[model samples]
Target: MTRITDTRDGPAEGARPGALPVAGLLLAAGGGRRLGGRPKALLGHLGRPLVEFAAGVLRDGGCVPRYVVLGARAADVRNRAELPGCVLVDNPGWADGMGSSLRAGLAALAATDAPAVLVTLVDQPRVGAAAVARLLAAHRAGAGLAAAAYGGERGHPVLFAREHWEGVALSAVGDRGARAYLRAHAGAVALVECGDVAAPDDVDTPEDLRLLD
Candidate 1:
């Protein structure tokens, strides 16, 4: 496996010795390079920062030991966002792409013995808590990998078991993020239909921002 720099430093909380604590890992470090370099975490979403909204989705969905990875105007995000209990991890290589943020989130979860991380993106406001809840159900049922599928197409808020975190991290390059890893193990991925509960629209470009309006 390729060795990346340590993107995390502290221990959040230890999971029970026999239990697999499921954590909420929000990848909010995107700089929104295509969106006029605005940090997605600080983008307005229904009168609040998108990071807070994204984290709420995870929290309300029943994920414990929540952690948010931040970069690209990290200090500004901290000062403005209302992230009360989330562990804020800074990914120095965030400019490189989403891979770093994903890695940072998993690294932080690993420190606490969290067997799995329910991952979400800050720009994806349409993926609601129901979608995440479905994935959580699959994880608790012993699915090593799970993702919300919209019209049979895999989308964000994926779940990764502890055993596969390293491989997923190693394969997470550029903005692809776990795609190649999941592709290679496609047969093992549990797909949950989320179209009925949520829309997988993302706030990538200016037009996508209107979803929050």
Candidate 2:
């Protein structure tokens, strides 16, 4: 587990000083109604659980102290997806919607000293570490907010600069996630074209999982 620190002292030897300090927050609080009440993050993909795969991607991309937001079947999901270095946080308000989970994640990120946060969903099993690294690299290059776009459709694992933390923290609970906020602050956004549509392929139903298989 790599420790997150203030990089201002200058990167170690050959490391770059401007490398953005970013933490990853995985939103796994969904109840999985479409999947028969199962925790989507706990669902298996090949030989690994979904959430574990997502965590692996973030970790490999150099995102430290990853936080997982659990809700409905928190225990079962947490027990089944025992990812190392992940901090599990329960969202009692998950019933409210994705907005609640987003807020909960933001609150957790707020507690950390990281200068930025990359938010992603647990259901998107195919979003790999390289994709996350791309977003982080773009953010470090001066983008206030960096996002992955597939075929021109912007999607998850959005990286937010500490400057926009307050906006995300104060978001209301509803079906819409951070689209509105991102749209309102379009001037500061740095859209990275991943050229892969699978980045936004979330397993919302059993059929979706089947498609991945």
Candidate 3:
């Protein structure tokens, strides 16, 4: 069973009054087979695990209830990282790929009744808090579908309203992960430009790791 630690919200303490509060859903379960089974969540960035940087982005961007989906090597991650205020969700089907983690993260939000969720990938350290804030601001401004656009190209850290959860979950198959769903609703998505503030370079191959300082 997926354990949702820190499930209590009560509007999540730090949310400003009248602000459109949303949960931050982090897909951090990748086993990184491409990186020889190294878990992406545990990858060191800035002397801290990548997950820590991601959570900071969400919090700084005003995401109320933060949820992190951990899969491959989940136990080791829990032991090595300090995700103090995040809801740690275990994705049993994580071996299947991003789709499983995506489903698990969203399902964990069932009881929170969050108006929306902002989803981000753990491997994109360069896609920092600033990009997240841009997408979050769009959500606050009532944009149902939003994402950080780099040079007008759609990318990660997408925001989906409450009503679109089911659709996203249904289409989140294999490693596609909301890609098909977002493509289906392109017109509805509000592209927030963040190229100036951040980049969405994912740390996948060893060479990509060089992007991190």
Q: How much lDDT does each candidate structure score?
A: 0.84, 0.76, 0.88
Model 2 RMSD, rounded to 1 decimal: 5.3
Decoy 1 TM-score against native: 0.90
Report the lDDT of model 3 for residue 15.
68
Question: Between 1 and 3, whose TM-score is larger?
Answer: 3
Off by over 4 Å in 3: 7-11, 17-20
Clashing residue pairs in all predictions, respectively, total: 0, 0, 0
- lDDT by residue (1-213, candidate 1, tens digit) is 222222234543333556666889899898888899999999998898889999889878878778888888988888898876577888888888988788887876776767788899888888888998899899888898999999999988899988899999999999889999999999999999999999888888988888885
Cα lDDT, model 3, residue 83: 82
Residue 119 error for model 3, in Å? 0.2
How well is each residue in 26-136 modelled by candidate 3, as lDDT tens digits?
Answer: 999999888888999999988998888888888887788899999989889888888867889999899998998999998989778689999999999888888888888
Off by over 4 Å in 2: 1-20
Error of 2 at 54 (Å): 1.0
Tens-place lDDT digits, model 2, residues 83-161: 7777777888887888888887777667767788898888887787777888989987888798888887788779998
Candidate order by lDDT, highest to lowest? 3, 1, 2
Q: How close is candidate 3 to the true structure, as a TM-score?
A: 0.95
